[model samples]
Target: MEETRPAPADLRGYCGNCFGLCCVALPFARSADFAFDKPAGTPCRNLLADHTCGIHTELRRRGFAGCTVYDCLGAGQKVSQVVFEGRDGGRRMHEVFPVVRQLHELLTYLTEALALPAARPVHAELREALDRTDALTRGTPEELTALDVGAHRQAVARLLFEASELTRAKVRGRKKRHRGADLMGARLKGADLRGADLRGAYLIAADLTGADLRSADLIGADLRDADLGGADLTGALFLTQPQVDAARGNAGTRLPGSVGRPVHWAAGG
Candidate 1:
């Protein structure tokens, strides 16, 4: 039996200072998951001028199931309040847009690092990084508004990669390095499997409803009944849209490869 990881407390709500960057910085495809396609750096069609989703109440009805599953790790508010210093929505969005997007990506990586079991032993280190990132978010308007964010994000990303490798080493049988392992009915729900090599792993009935599989190599992994209901698999490799549909998922699941969400979920048939 695989040990399960505990769910992390919701930390996004405490970050009200964001400008809703994720909705703007990220892109979406028109499919069962989203009502329309949005390009990176362009505001989502459903995004109001105020940076809020226009169809917030009807995301599922509108087919944007993917949009509903994303979390910004509080970086959205931090970038808006600290980096942009509460700039009006009408200001030079083009100038600061790239910075906000980069910061959001960095936050996504850091958040994944914090959830890995390998990082558990070094959680204090991860927490310290989080604190520093948080502090950067609260920096003076001048400091936050600058454009040297790439360097900062790269530095943190290196640490996260190291932590992920360390944690993945602890899982049993995973060390065999199979290109694809059979893992049916494994009960790995809510496991912290960041950066693990799951290339082509058979995960039928694995119950990975809310597992943190960020940056993990899942090339060709079978996902029947995997239950990714609330899981974040951003940057996870080799995942296909067909694999997602074959599995059980709800509105809260986030996936990779820009696959459209399943429409049957909305009809509840």
Candidate 2:
């Protein structure tokens, strides 16, 4: 099959060319997010032979809500169709997947950083990092498994922080600093959160209608059911698919280029 290259920010899980790596390679602990514990290296019972999920449509109803938050950032296809092209699934396939998954996640952010107009000062560095990361993704499975991902992440992280500062600096007025705050169910409507250091903040069910979140570092922030109506999230750092999927947003909410509009947003969920 011909590989149709998608835009960098549009990277997503293409399960067709994947061997259901997310279902098998990653372990799931039994919790509200997941109904039952699933060990790593074991395929879920719902995974079909053709690499499709049998209970895909009824995942939430069947207590597999954790699957909805996952986004491989196109790593699954890269692993299945590139690294292990001539080989079949084995212990190696499962082992290398986690590493590649992290690499692709970084790529997702780096790709968006390149597209940010305010982040132009670091575009060259971002491009260099992107190239290096892309090269690493194409490395052999052994190399991927052995990669120093922590070191690479630290290097790229500085560039991303610089880019965030550049973008958030454009926002007028004082910026809010809510880093790691327990703001659960807090009403922050129309608040100015530009360049806010909200990393690891607990925003579960918070009301942020029409809030300005530009360039806020949302790494590890819990946004479950947070109202984001008309909020501006352009250049928001470390925002992920799962966070967006869990949040409440309408057509008016502006998101970063890296993520797509959640299906639930369109259906008026």
The best candidate in terms of lDDT: 2
Candidate 2 versus truth, CA RMSD in Å, comes to 3.7
Report the lDDT tens digits of candidate 2 across residue range 148-204: 999999999889878877877887777787878999999999988888988789999
Clash pairs, model 2 backbone: none
- C-alpha lDDT of all candidate models, in order: 0.62, 0.84
Give the TM-score comparing model 1 with the true structure, all chains together.
Answer: 0.52
| TM-score of each model, paired residue for residue | 0.52, 0.87
lDDT string for model 1 (90-166, tens) is 33443454455455445444666666665677666666676666556555545656747868866775676567567
- Which portions of model 2 miss their true places by more than 4 Å? 1-6, 234-238, 256-258, 266-268
Worst 10 residues of 1 by lDDT: 2-11
